[model samples]
Target: MRLTHSCIITNEVKKLSEFYEKVLQIKAETSGDEYAEFPTDCGILSIFSFSLQESLAKGSSLPGSNRNLILEFNVANVDDEYMRLEKLGVEFVKPLTTQPWGNRSFYFQDPDGNMLNFYTKVK
Candidate 1:
């Protein structure tokens, strides 16, 4: 079996799609007005609709606003991407640093505080 797409339940689908498109230079595919997708060479990044009020009413949402997942993007240059995204107003949770395993990496947060990483091999 193959993984087609992974979804992040978000209240602001349009905002997220816009952010990803601008920051990552990705094209989002539209599935009606509720869903947006980023078509990857392999799979796709799908943003699904979520209602905080409904989740709270159903006792599904936690007390806090943050989700419990992080998404990673393996890029060609973590440092370059980090700088470019910083200029685009994407907030970084951690600055890019070289790993002991010889990879350079950094972490950032999405509009909904979903952790994201950009990493590249260190030469």
Candidate 2:
């Protein structure tokens, strides 16, 4: 089966969604006060809220409250993308570096602490 959409749980979904829309140039739609959906070239990007009390009661942690997951965006040019995004005030874990796999990449974190990587093939 093909994947359709993926979601990140945040305490402030609206704010995070707006950040994505503003900084990453993603146009996202909000559903009342619950969630946001972004239609990308490949698939839909979704963000929703997780009530800490309810999730803790159910013994499940919020999606990004813990590590072990990473979301990556592939770009045509990592350096150009990094400069553009940096100008928009996005925080990067590190500047774009060339990987042994013949790609230039960098890492960052989302509002909820989900690790993100942007990569492009090195020529």
Candidate 3:
């Protein structure tokens, strides 16, 4: 089975979309006033406004709701990406560090404090 998308619900679709635009270096397609989707290489990352969430049974509790799951992105060069993102004022939880598992990695947070990892495999 393939995972088509990983969706995030927030009250700020446009703001969050803009955040991803800078961080992911991709554009977002707005479905309406309340939703936008980024078509990434692996899968789509979507954001929905609270207006859309209100239409559902429960309201969205985004931003700081998730704690355990991390969103990871693989890059051709982790250090280069780190430098680029840092220049864009991205806040990192961890600086670039080579792991024992043969991966050079770093961690950071999105505008909503969504944990993210950018890494590259090293032999």
Q: Quick one: best lDDT, which candidate?
A: 3
**Cα displacement (Å) at residue 57, model 3:** 2.5
lDDT (0-100) at residue 60 of candidate 1? Answer: 55
Q: Report lDDT (Cα) of residue 86, candidate 2.
A: 89
Pairwise TM-score winner, candidates 2 and 3: 3
lDDT of 3 by residue, 3-24 (tens): 9998787767788899999988
Per-residue accuracy of model 1 over 3-120 as CA lDDT, tens digit each: 8887766778888888878866888888776788998777788776676435545655432266567767778777788889888887778888988998799888878787787899
Per-residue lDDT of 1-123 in model 2, one digit per residue for the tens? 888887777778777887788756878788777788988778888887677435545645455574787777788788888998888888998778998988899988887788888899877
Off by over 4 Å in 1: 51-67
TM-score for every candidate vs. truth? 0.83, 0.85, 0.92
Model 3 deviation from the true structure expressed as Cα RMSD, one decimal place: 1.5
Q: Candidate 2: which stretches are off by over 4 Å?
A: 52-57
Which regions in candidate 3 have their CA more than 4 angstroms from the true location? 59-63
lDDT of 1: 0.77
